[model samples]
Target chain A: MTDFAIDLKDVDKLYGGVFSRRVHALRGVDMRVGRGEIFGLLGPNGAGKSTLVKILMTVIRATRAMGTVLGRPVGNKPTLARVGYLPEHHRFPDYLTGRQVIEFYGAMSGVSRHERRKRAAELLDFVGMGKWADTRVRGYSKGMRQRVGIAQTLVNSPDLVIWDEPTDGVDPVGRRDIRQMTVELKRKGTTVMLNSHLLSELEMVCDRVAILVQGKVSSQGTIDELTVHRQRYEIEVSAGDSHVDAGVRKALAGWLPDGALEGRLEGGQTLKANFDSPHLPALITVSTADAQPVQPIIDALRNARLTVRAVKPIRPSLEDLFMEAVTDPVTGRTLAPGAKEGA
Target chain B: MVLRQTLAILGDAYRELNAKKMFWITLALSAFVVLAIACVGINSKGISVLWWTFPVDVFNTAIVSPALFYKLIFIGFGFKFWLTWAATILALISTASLIPDFVAGGSIDLMLSKPIARLRLFLTKYATGLLFVGLQVMVFSVASFLVIGIRGGVWDWKIFVAVPLVLLFFSYLYCVCVLIGIVTRSTIAALLLTVLFWFVLFLLHSGEQSLNLFKLNAEEQTATLEARAEPLSDQIAKSKAVIAQLSEAPTDETAEARGRREGELATKNASLTGLELRQQSTAKDLESYRASLGRLKLWHDVLFSVKTALPKTSETMELLQRVLTSSDETSKLEDAEQQRREERGTRRRDADAAKRDADNEADRGGPGFSPSVVRRQEEINRSRSVWWILGTSVAFEALVLAVACTIFVRRDF
Candidate 1:
């Protein structure tokens, strides 16, 4: 079997027929999620995040696809028995109770009656919905429904679970519960794929992530790999009434030569010396995550009797990676939000 | 796996119907209808409602048996009116939204993501929609079975056939509803268009039957005219021969005898002319009716072919009539009723009144009541075999469902 729970290659989805207005929802998207890992999919609104998840679940047919989900070709009916999906804005029948909803979906997934009954109860209590298990879903609040939606997804004990906006309409406590459940699923060797706009939540739980922009995957990798190049260290020196006191500038004169204040250091790392005029600290930024390179700058400030207030290492966040993926590099403006229209 | 999925959908459908107040309301109405059937009784004197007997001569128990009366009421009022018309309408209204709601955005996503195939999912849901009518008809048939047994004193097991018959009849229309629902995804459109389709079927059926009645009437008229013409033509030939014989005097005849022969010859000629006049009138009528018959047959055939290609809703329901009552029993009832009417006519009519009434009746439907218009209509309906009635209808339903399944399977929710 393939190591990935999902291995999609060159997937494309065109929404309408020739006579109608068409949308190119997904344009050659390639994505992968390794087994026993929590993978996050982040995108702007209408960027085809949901569309890709749907294609894997066989909810939408792709125009051109080459991939396997759980070691079977995409859209294979039998393969879905090992997969679970909680769609965005999923609506259960109002007539069914919470427990009935779970049991019904479990039965549909080919789970036997006794197992369905047992799992439904356990899952309901796990989601903290045991008190409302017998109540009809029509009377439940949105957060309650979301909890039930999550419970139903796990009824079959799927090997791969894809949840789109699992924490939508949920309170903070509920969101935490969902996160913990996702982690628990991963701990049990289940591959969890989550698509949500809550970047912080995904950042906390995801081992790897793919950022989609305008129907294409702009970046895909572990957080450390994606943020490695953008990681840096900031050295702030105390500024006098003149913003950057003469002592601070004189101390860093080697890194910032007279005519060129920003240049490469001896270690071949980018070093930019900032001397602000207003009442603020004069800063030195080293474009390397290694702490060895920043020790000399701090030593120079100290030997010159210049106050060295702080030296800190900064790593780009998932949100930062998300913003960079969606932004137009040439224009320095955010890219248009939606999938493009095509012939 | 398929069985489990199918049972899940069926269970969901039952729960959905259980939640709708209309389901319980319809069941209550059916009970009331059965109770109402139980309240009305046929007795030795006449029809009885509750404790009161309204004296009637023709429909008394002596003329109609309790078994036959109850069967008639069950087939006529219970099956035809309540189950076919009223209950079917309620079923359509309640279940019209089933397909549209099933394929709705969020709902369909959940269903389609399951391990089941799209075609199987769609078909199971479609069958589940019929659960509304199936349950309704089952309850109605069971109650009527009890009523017919207890009240009419005949525990006819055959009454249960109404359950499947009515369900089949409703399926013919429900298939159309499902097609429209899948296409438009609007409950109102599906319900209205399905009802309209049924009305068109009713109109076509009525048209075929009406044209057949006229065709039969015209054929009867032509036959009567031909029968009258034969004797009149013989009489005319005989009169002419006698006149010819009398016009020439015998050699031994006296003048007085010859003059008497002349008078007799004149009388024969006049009689022959009158007979010839009737022959001319009959020939004219024969031509008219023959022409009318040709026109009626053309239109009837046209309608018959059109109706043949469509589901036979009326004929499908009439299947119950065949299984419920024997032809012999109905014929006996009809003969008794006819004899009673004739006896009443004898008491009410003198010679003049009788002749006037006969002429009036002749003008009404052309010659001798057309010899059982009701029986002829029943014969036309009964001539339809089970295969033609249900097979063609099921073929039509299958065609419609095929189209619907294609849409449901191909559509992206």
Candidate 2:
């Protein structure tokens, strides 16, 4: 078994063939999920997030894929016993009760009868659906169906669970329950791969995340690793008498050799001095996660008798990383959502 | 694992059908039919409905044994009309959405994500489509079995064969339904197309049967005509020999002898002319029959070839009849009816002949029927091996299912 719960290498999916219209849904993607972590897969609509998940689940065959899910080759049927999946917009037969739906899928996953029945009861309660377990799905609201969907996913006690929008259509309370469920599943050493559009929710719970744009992964890492370069310390100061820009520029003149200071610090952190504000306080920014690099600037402002109003450290949010991934660098606009056409 | 999955799907199918009001509705209808069958009784004097007796001379117990009579009714009306046609249509309407619902976007993804192989999952789902018919037929057959046993005074286990035969018959059409359901993914399209396919099959089967009847009748007529012509031809030759011998002048013959010889020659010559005319007429009849036989055989062969490649829905159900009652019993019933009709006199005969003529005219525009024509048609049908009937049909179903499965397994749900 591999150390990773999911190790996908060079995965590719082409929806249609040469003679027909084609959609290169997934490019050559290489992704890895650690054994016991919540890996969030964030992307825009049609960005191939679901396509990649389905390929791993064997719901859609890949044009070419090399990976292992749950320590077996991708698309291996038996290995799916250890891998649970809750598809987006999943539909259960309306005739069945919520409990029956769970047991049915559990049986399909090759879980024994007694075990699945026991787990189904427990999972239903775990998802807060125990009260409605015997209710037919036909009578369920969308949130109820979502709760049952999550319950069915864990019925087999899978080691790796892939949930595509687990909180879809769920109420806030139910969403929190699902979030807690993932954490509970993690506490038991289960790998959870979440694909959702809710970046804040993922930011609250995900341990690591991959950002896919136009069928390619733009970046993938822990939140800190991804936002490190964008992390900065900003020092806002004011001249008690005169314009803040002039006071700040005059105070930092020694720190600038050519009347401007815009370069990397000695420790390879980016540094820029801003003095263009006429009415606002001039700002000095350092592109490093460390606070020590900004202390000297704070001391220099104090020595110049310029009041240092605030010195704050800032780090980019998950939404910021997501937006940057989807936005085109040259166009300064969001890239067209969805997989690119052609090969 | 496979067994668990199979049972799970089967259980799901039962629940699905259980939820459909049509399933129970069809079952209730079946019970009504069985009860209706049970209420009708055959006494020595006549046929009875509950307490009331309507005397049917030919169909009475004196003419048909109660066992054979009830068997015939069950096979003809119950099995053929209700189970195979009416209930099958009901089952089709109830279960038509099976595959389309299965492969619907949200549903199929969950199934495909399961650990079961795609082919197994697809085939199991397809089989569940037949489950509606299977349950309907099973309940109907068991009920009919008890009806026949209690009312008819015979417990024929062979009556239970309807379960499998009807299931097989339903599957033939259900397979087509599944293939269309997979391709179109629309319940209405699947149902309508499957019914159309069944109609085509029925047409082909009926065409082949009608042509075979005509062809067999023509062959029998040709044999009869040939049999009649032989003696007439021999007599004509003898008359010619006698006339030729007499036509020569005799040496030292008296006038009376000559006159006698001339009279004899004239008689022989006249008889010869009459025989030759009859021979010509017989030859003409033979030619016509042979020509008709040739044409009938050609058309029958064409339909037979086409029908051979398709499922034999009627013939498959007919197999249950063959198993339930022997030909001897059927023939006895037929002979008693024939005797009763013969007692009615020449008027009945004339009407029968006129009807036969009309029937022959209707059947491929051919003429004639031997009493053995019906039996000959039965013989032709019975001549088909169970293997050929079911095997080729299943082969057709398998082909359609294979195509459906290929699409199902390869499709990106």
Top candidate on lDDT is 1
lDDT of 2 at A98: 96
Residue-level lDDT tens digits of model 2 in B1-413: 99999999999999999999999999999999999999988998889999999988778876789998889889988999999889989988998999999989889989999899999999999888888988888888889889888989899888889988988999899989998999999999999999999999998888888888888888888998999999988898888888899999789999999999999888888889899999999999999999999999999888888888999998898898789888888887878766654455445456686565454433322345545787778788888999989999999989999999999988888
Please state the i-RMS of candidate 1.
Answer: 0.7
Candidate 1 chain B lowest-lDDT run of ten: B362-371
What is the per-residue lDDT of model 1 for residues A143-240, given as tens digits with 9 covering 90 to 100?
99999999999999999999999999999999999999998999999999999999999999999999999899999999989998999999888755
Find the 10 residues in a row with the least total lDDT in model 2 chain B.
B357-366
TM of chain B, each: 0.94, 0.91
- Which clashing pairs does model 2 show? none
Residue B225 error, candidate 2, Å: 2.5
Note the Cα lDDT for every prediction shown.
0.90, 0.88
Candidate 2, A185: how far from true, in Å? 2.2
Q: What's the TM for model 2?
A: 0.94
Candidate 2 regions exceeding 4 Å error are B239-278, B345-367
Pairs in steric clash, model 1? none
